[model samples]
Target: MSLFSRRKLSEYEPNDHQYQLNKLNFKVTKLEDRIDNLENDWECASQGESFQLANGIDAKEAANRVEKAAQKALPNELKKAFDEINSAVKNEQQSIRLWQYKLGIVNGEPQWVRIYHIAALSRELKKYGYETKLDSNDSDGRFSSLKVSWEGKETSDISKIDPAKKYILPLEDTECEITDSVTGKAISHEVAYACPRDDKWEIIYERKIYSDAVVVPGKNIISAPNWVKSIEPIEAD
Candidate 1:
């Protein structure tokens, strides 16, 4: 017989059983509502948590400071390197270029590397004061290596930081567009590298989920533009 049939209802002489079924259904409905509320809360929290880092500052704020720092005369070999590279690009005909050169280790030692994403480098340097040490269209005019820091309050000390290090540009994490692994949807991820080894210029970018950031294992860094944002330096273990 059907559970809802009159015969089944009559089977419960005290009517207690039928009443309990109704109570159970009501409880199930309440539980479902609670589950839905929890799901919504989780979604919002997940979205917020993604942009946050182990560092206390907002990723956006750190990125802005980085970008602004790009405009300032950088410290260490940054300003000198930035100036030399920036100057050379202006004389080139292409919008994008990569420069390769060798330079000293404070006492005439040498290193070999190339600076890619030339146009992007030029753009960031434009935000700062323009000065290039490149005296000729040839490589000889370019310092090839950094010697001293630029003259200004904006200088960063190379004593603590290496001038060859890669850094993120002053870009918001939201500027990084990526396809979600789970949803297959495009979304913004926090990003912080801009220029190169010089400043917004170098590549030590903001921390994000491994999936959200691109990494190059075994390579020295230089800054570029949006197209080059995928390169995050991976530290050796």
Candidate 2:
């Protein structure tokens, strides 16, 4: 029997409640999991899916997909970083310029040409143009501005990205038991690395493909034996 009964699963019915529960009742799960551990587990593993941190790439990819649905987009800082180096190279006009011009470095263009490029792109960004502008007042170069668009109707000024999915990637190793089909023997494989699955917001490991690394999304991934920091061979001690 459950030690706590705030509401049963049936209470959250044929609506948006399941996802909402993941958001609203997620924290409570830590405590619930602990209590269930101390007693008979009321939180059944038979449920569709449990939780883990979605890998970082998975989260970032999710954000990028959303941005693309809006239109072409570029993070402002990406451009600023390019500028800081390009400008540094330009300001070093000391004696390198004569030679740089000879070598056709940066196409021998002056600062104005670069700035013009940014301005022009921003002006027509809504029509599938992209551009960046540096903030002279900001020495750190963090305040660079970016404009990107492809549809000529809507443009995005996205300075930040947030993952839409609930999973956060696990920081440490995940442990599991694997039964060898050939021998019908239960063995253990510790996950050393994990990556995004082809499906949306899913994760996989590079199991068996490389001898040193154990894959994350194998047959037994759902039945976690115990998540731990080290999956060292059991006989190591």
Candidate 3:
């Protein structure tokens, strides 16, 4: 018989078993409702926890990626800036060097070794305020070697300096002498040397004195125009 089948209502006694069965069914329904509620709450809590954890993880990963990229790019960028600064400094130093070379402020003597004769030695001397001891138009009237001196306020002793090394001028011709054979006029030119040995004046080099041609300015040194006419080959007098 089906559990729902009904018997003759009056004849069936309403026993304690029937009453207990009704109470048990009611309690089971309430328990099932409570379980459903508990399950819903658990699911909600789990979903919330999952969302928070995932969000935190994703956020952390993104931040780490950004930091890595920044780290990788920083050194190269800094290096590029440093290279630019270095290049700028090099260019500035080059410009200063050019200026110093042009001004003739470079250390040491000029390289006149290759040249057999220094063309504008007299002109350079005049520019530095050293007066030419000899001046002549005729090649024969020129001084073989002119003595130059500094009449300026700041004069140095000449003996302390080496004469052989001072302003060395090469000889174009050994037989050069400054004399006006036709006019019978000869020039005895003397050059001044800024004495480093003593504050006294001394004639270190002298020439029989002859003029061949006027000295021209060289490439590396400043030359005074009209000051230096020509260089003559001089011998030790």
TM-score of each: 0.24, 0.16, 0.18
| Candidate 2 local lDDT, 1-237, one digit each (tens) | 563453564465645676777876887988888887745433444554444444535677887765443222222222332334335435652111100011223657633112222322233332322232323334432233333322232222121112221212222223334689999787755332322344322223333223422233322232222111111112100
**Candidate 1 lDDT trough over 10 residues, lowest sum:** 153-162
Full-model lDDT for every candidate: 0.42, 0.33, 0.35
Q: Model 3, which residues run further than 4 Å from truth?
A: 1-48, 52-57, 91-237
> Could you tell which candidate, 1 or 2, scores higher by lDDT?
1
By TM-score: ranked, best first: 1, 3, 2
Error of 1 at 188 (Å): 2.6
Error of 3 at 76 (Å): 2.4
Tell me the deviation in Å of residue 55 in model 2.
16
Residue-level lDDT tens digits of model 3 in 93-193: 21100000112323575431211011233333343334544333345322233334433422112222233432322322222234676886665543321
Instruction: Write the residue-wise lDDT of candidate 1 on 85-149 in tens digits.
Output: 44544654222222424453645656643332222344434434332232125554343322221
Please give the distance, in angstroms, between residue 90's alpha carbon in candidate 1 and its true position after superposition. 25
Candidate 3 root-mean-square deviation in Å: 36.7
Which ranges of candidate 2 are over 4 A from the true structure? 1-43, 46-74, 92-237
Q: How far does residue 37 in candidate 3 sit from its true spot (Å)? A: 18
